[model samples]
Target: MTQRYSVLLWLTGGLVVLFLIAPILAIMPLSFNSEPFFTYPMPGLSLRWYEEFFTSNVWLMSLKNSLIVAVCATILATFLGTLAAIGLARKECPVRGLIMAILISPMIVPIVVSAVGIYYAFAAVGLLNSLTGLILAHTALGAPFVLITVSASLAGFDYNLMRAAANLGARPHTATLQIMLPMIAPGVFSGALFAFATSFDEVVVALFLTGSEERTLPKQMWSGVREQLSPTIAAVATMLILLSTLLLIVMLWLQNRAEKQKQRLEG
Candidate 1:
């Protein structure tokens, strides 16, 4: 009965994976379609759409904007989230639970609601339809992932290391940089990857906050879907899929390394 249940579980899991990935895989061939239409059994395969994506001003500009915003947001989110995680990791930190809840609330809240709220708030401050506004909004959304990852890394941390550093006359900043940062680097890196991916793929908030000049890749894709379905969109989607896969690999590697480090420490 247990073996039968295990086989059933495997089959169920495989179906779920197929359901999630089938649509994404279906588009890959369409991206290379020579006839400029998304259809099965393409007339021929060509790199025209990929070429267009690279050369087209609109697509190129949106890609550039996405990179800029994602990079900036990742840096800001990682820094702020790392700090928050450290503070919350402390036993005596005041209102630690409350602060963590507030910090991560953006992740819990509905994105549309958060986007609308951000739009109104930014409009009041004259930051609406701006890159700065988009970066700030994405930072808010991405920080929670960083907080979670970094906090997990801190879970296995030994306070004795910090105490030892202090005993050896190391400054607090020195201890953090030389000791704590090394031990937690994997989590920090994984969190930064998540932050970058979050900002890169975000659409709803980008729609609310970004102007024409500040349009992101996802916003451009949304526009293409609405205005006219193009193979170029498919090409971009394929590229994004590749990028996401690479990030996932890196995150998994980091997680494995962190686990190994933890085991070594414990042993």
Candidate 2:
């Protein structure tokens, strides 16, 4: 009975995987379809959509804006998140739970609620429809991911190492930069990568905060889909899938490296 159940579980899991991947897999080949609309079996294969995606200034400009926002958000989120993680890892802080809850509150709050609040706030500050404003908004939303990853890494960290460095007359800042930073580098990198991905893919806040000049790739794709169901979006989606897969592989490598380093240090 147990063996039968295990086989059943494996089969069920396989179906779930297929369910999740089938739609995404459908997009790639459909992008190559010569059909004017989204459909199966291209009248013929062509790269016209991809070519359009590359050459169109609207699409290209949105891609550039997305990259800029992602990069800026990654930097800000990583810095702020890493610092918060380090501060929390110190046992001396009172009300650490409260602090952590506050830090991660953004993740728990509904995106729509946050978006509404941010929209009004940015409008008041004249940050609405601006790239800098979009970047800042994304950074705020993405920071929680970085904080979670770094905090998980630091949970296994040895405080004794910090004490040793301090005892050796290394200043706190020096110890952090030279020792702690190196030790947690993998987590930091993974966190930053995740931040970049989150910012790159985000749409809700972008819809609220951005305009024609600052519209991200996702927002542009969204509008295209709404207006005319362009198959060029399928091509863009395929590219995003490829990009996300590459980032995922990098994140997995960083995680594995961090685990190995942790073992070596602990051993």
- Give TM per candidate: 0.97, 0.97
Estimate the TM-score for candidate 1.
0.97
Best by lDDT: 1
List model 2 lDDT by residue over 183-223, tens digit each: 88899999999999999999999999988888899999999
Q: Kindly give the stretch of ten consecutive residues in candidate 2 with the minimal lDDT sum.
A: 34-43
Clashing residue pairs in candidate 2 (N, C-alpha, C atoms within 3 angstroms)? none
Give me the overall lDDT of model 2: 0.92
Candidate 1 per-residue lDDT, tens place, 134-245, comes to 9999999999999999999999999899999999999999999999999999999999999999999999999998888889999999999999999999999999999999
In order, the Cα lDDT scores of the candidates are 0.96, 0.92
How far does residue 253 in candidate 2 sit from its true spot (Å)?
1.2
Error of 2 at 207 (Å): 0.7
For candidate 2, the TM-score is 0.97
Over 4 Å off, model 2 = none
